[model samples]
Target: MIEIFTDGASSGNPGPGGYGAILKAGSHYKELSGGFRKTTNNRMELLAVIKALEAIKKPNQTITIYSDSKYIIDAIEKKWVYGWIKKGFKDKKNKDLWLQLMEYFKLHQIRLVWVKGHAGHPENERCDELAVAAAKQPALPADLFFEAEAAREKLF
Candidate 1:
């Protein structure tokens, strides 16, 4: 089984944000991260998971994801995202990321495990460090998630 740990950080709400992900399968390991000039912590959190899953080269692999975001854990495990999908994600935030996540989720046997942030967990701590550092990096390109959100709002 593959093990994945992820974390997200934001300098401020609607400010610079980034996500960190560490994926381990057998003896192989990979780390992924990216920064956004303007975004939210929650968006980064979900993006971390989505990016990690997208990194997996093989579909149908059993994977366990450790995340500190209750927003992500509860949304999927508690079936809230499913309900939102059924409702066409109307009146919901982060609909773009949610829909993207659900697409990747359907391709793999995935499990979400909630872990306490800032805890002593080694991988989790490292993820947090990566996330914070990415958020502090020099100005990078805009986040597609946020850009998509802006475009969607213009339609209504």
Candidate 2:
């Protein structure tokens, strides 16, 4: 079984943001993270999970994911994402990330466990630190999807 702990951080709700993920299998561990100059916390949250899943080498693996974002956890666990997918993700915020995540669902047996943020969980804390540090990087790249969406929204 593989275990993953993830967290996301933003300097502001829709400001600079980043995601952190720690993957553990047997005696091996890996950490992943990236930053965006402009993005939402939820986007980072979802991206963390997607990146972690993409890191796995083998398909059909059993995986457990620990996340602090109820936005990501509840959406999957409560079957909301499935419904959204059926509806072609109409009125959805992060359609790109959600679609990317669902692609991994077919390859892995994934279980999502929500953990309280800043609750002293070691792996969770480490993820949080990684996310925050990434968000602070001097020259993060633009989140193209987010920028395009924001631009489109402004025209309305």
**Highest TM-score, which number?**
2
Q: For every model shown, what is its TM-score relative to the native structure? A: 0.93, 0.98
Instruction: Give Cα distance to truth, residue 146, candidate 2, Å.
Output: 0.8
User: Model 1: what TM-score?
Assistant: 0.93
lDDT of 2 by residue, 1-156 (tens): 999999999999899999999999999999999999999999999999999999998999999999999999899889999999899988889999999999999999999999999999999999999999999999999999999999999999
lDDT of each: 0.91, 0.95
lDDT (Cα) of model 2: 0.95
User: After superposing candidate 1, which stretches have Cα over 4 Å from the reference?
Assistant: 147-156
Which residue pairs clash within candidate 1? none
Question: Clash totals for all models, in order?
Answer: 0, 0
Q: Model 2, stretches more than 4 Å misplaced? A: none
